[model samples]
Target: MRYNIIHRTTYKYESPVTVGHYMARLEPRTLPFQECPWHELTIFPSPIERAERSDYFGNTNVYFEIEGSHQKLEVIARSLVEVIRAQPFDPASTPPWETIRDSCRSDVYNPATPAGELTFASTLIPVGVPYADYARPSFLPGRPILQGVCDLNRRIHRDFVFDPKATDAATPVEKVLKQRRGVCQDFAQVMIACLRSLGLPARYVSGYLETVPPPGVVKLVGADASHAWVSVYCGEVCGWMDADPTNDVLPSERHITVAWGRDFADVSPLRGVTTGAGEQRLKVAVDVLPDKD
Candidate 1:
């Protein structure tokens, strides 16, 4: 499937003046599951200086400085990508929960992968056990599996919610687990913290979700926004399996990768700091459209 994405983020300030710098991670990368043939980003009221580099996590970073006195700013990113992903339905060959846990230890790392760092502590996912002794799906009849890390990707999906306002970027895992509401980022973080707590490693992913409406229903422009998820290492044979806890499904052709890192802070689409502003307001609009024939 091919898609054309247009994302516009506008900031309207009550008062604006002086210097500002921003970090942007809006470009998509070609991974095993998707192909990004073309991608571009444009900023209105262009900045005075711009620099681009790859972060330690292998995510492309764009840093720019804008110096002036303006009350409004708008940044737009557009891209066209062709995605091809495969679905593997066999579950019997899936490793048992214990084996997956044992494989993920604090010392495993894949230098070849973009992140350049891979280990069990980084991959182990966290889970929240309402009761410390409850029986988990991947655990023995009487024992409990750790809170975040699940043996299989399918289990992660079944145990989370996709509430946009459940938590903000600053919310902690303990709080999110207590509220039981959060966006994909929250779920991914909880999973990461759990994995790390158990001496495993995990990483966060940011991307887009291809939404298909029911038959005869018109697709709304900008209705589909960017998405977030996580990945955990399960030994060399199983490798890193991507899981979307928000949607409760494994990644398929419907998913597109933009960037990845330890957490959302490392790969936010847009982040910046400004001096000399009493207050500010922000508005965002995103459109993921199928390419025209």
Candidate 2:
């Protein structure tokens, strides 16, 4: 499926900013499952200096500096991407949860992926009392699919509320789980942390959400918005399965990939530092339109 995405962000300052800087991670990367045909960005009152580089996590970073007093700043990003993701429901010969767990041991669990990336660490994802107790040896390994790393994805959907204002980017996973409310980013992070606690590799994903309109109704334009999810490596055959605990669904034709990384900090669409700006307000708007072809 193909989509044309338009995203605009504007910043207003109470006082004119003499100097400002920003880091942008809006470019999409080509993966085994997705493709990027064209992508570009434009900033209003163009900055005097700009630089681009790739972060450690493989996300593209655009940095810019603006000099001279300015009351407002605007950044616009547009992209046309052709995404071809695999169907989650595709039948395979992989063993079920029971057979897989029986062949695996708790001590042998490691969260590193085949590529040698540490997908999860204890510091990032601590195992709570309930989680540790539930995975003990006395329990029936096959029966407690809810005890291990794989269960983090489903547990989040079953336990939390999709509250947009419930938390912010800095909120911790324990807090999110305790409150049982947050947006897609929050849910994705919690899942990432939980999976890592259980020694599994997980990563955060950023993209666009495709809205499904009622029958016979044309999909609402601009109704679509930015979305976040998590991808966990579930062994050799299953590879990485994208899960959206916020919506309790898998990535389909509707999910458009923009970027991915270990966490939001690694793939935030826009972030940066500034000088001479006492305070600033930000406004953002996103539109996802289906291609006619």
Candidate 3:
């Protein structure tokens, strides 16, 4: 499947006087099952300095600074990407949850390896007995790691309500667990916290999930939104696999992966520090349309 994604972010400040610096992680990643042929970032009130680099997790990151001031700031990211469905596998065939958990816990201090790096708690998600207990039902003794993950994913989808008003980006996972409501970010983080609490390796994936309109209804231009999911390492042979608790499905061709890390902070689409800009209003519009031709 091919897609044309446009992500637009606007910030309107009550007062703007000086400079602004920002970093954006909006480019889609190129994985074995994904390829981004073209991507571009357009910033209004053109930045004085701009550069691109790869972050530690290998996501494409852009940095820019605006020397002069403006009350309104706009940054638009556009990309064309192709994604293929990942090969299907039997979750029950994978290693037991205990085996993977033990292997990761033994050498978790070594952040050099990707799996090891994610096995511990991070800024947003915490590991604790509560999270582990929440996950225990799905991870019975000798249960396959992927099997348990899929069960956990399904449980979250069934248990929680997707209420945007219930939580924000800074909402804690523990709170979300108690409230049983939040957007995709909360669901993904809660799952990560649950897995990490059990000494399992899991990472947060930030990306786009295609949304389809009703059969007779026209698709709105900016109806889609940024999405988040979870990926678990099921030992070496099976490698890392993705699960979307928000939708109760494994990520596939419709999922466009951007960047992933231990949590959302590491791969926020756009983040910046502004001088002299107080009382800001943020508006984000995202479009994930199927590419023609």
Give, for candidate 2, the lowest lDDT window spanning 10 residues. 138-147
Sort every candidate by lDDT, greatest first: 3, 2, 1
How far off is residue 108 in model 1, in Å?
9.2
Question: Candidate 2: which stretches are off by over 4 Å?
Answer: 89-116, 121-152, 214-221
Clashes of each: 30, 0, 0
Residue ranges of candidate 3 with Cα displaced over 4 Å: 107-114
TM-score of each: 0.82, 0.82, 0.97
Residue-level lDDT for 98 in candidate 3: 90
Report how far off residue 3 is in candidate 3 (Å): 0.5
lDDT of 1 by residue, 1-293 (tens): 89898888888778874778889898888777677788787886699999999998778888988899887778898888888876653444544545545545325644324222433223223344431222243445322222233442344455656677777767776777667678877777766665544434467899888788899999887788778887765445555667777776777777888998777777889998887756888788888887886
TM-score of 2: 0.82
Better candidate by TM-score, 1 or 3:
3
66-91 per-residue lDDT for model 2 (tens digits): 88888888888898877787655442
Identify the runs in model 1 with alpha carbons over 4 angstroms from their true place: 94-136, 139-161
Ranking by TM-score: 3, 2, 1
User: Per-residue lDDT for 231 in model 1?
Assistant: 74
For candidate 3, the C-alpha RMSD (Å) to the true structure equals 1.8
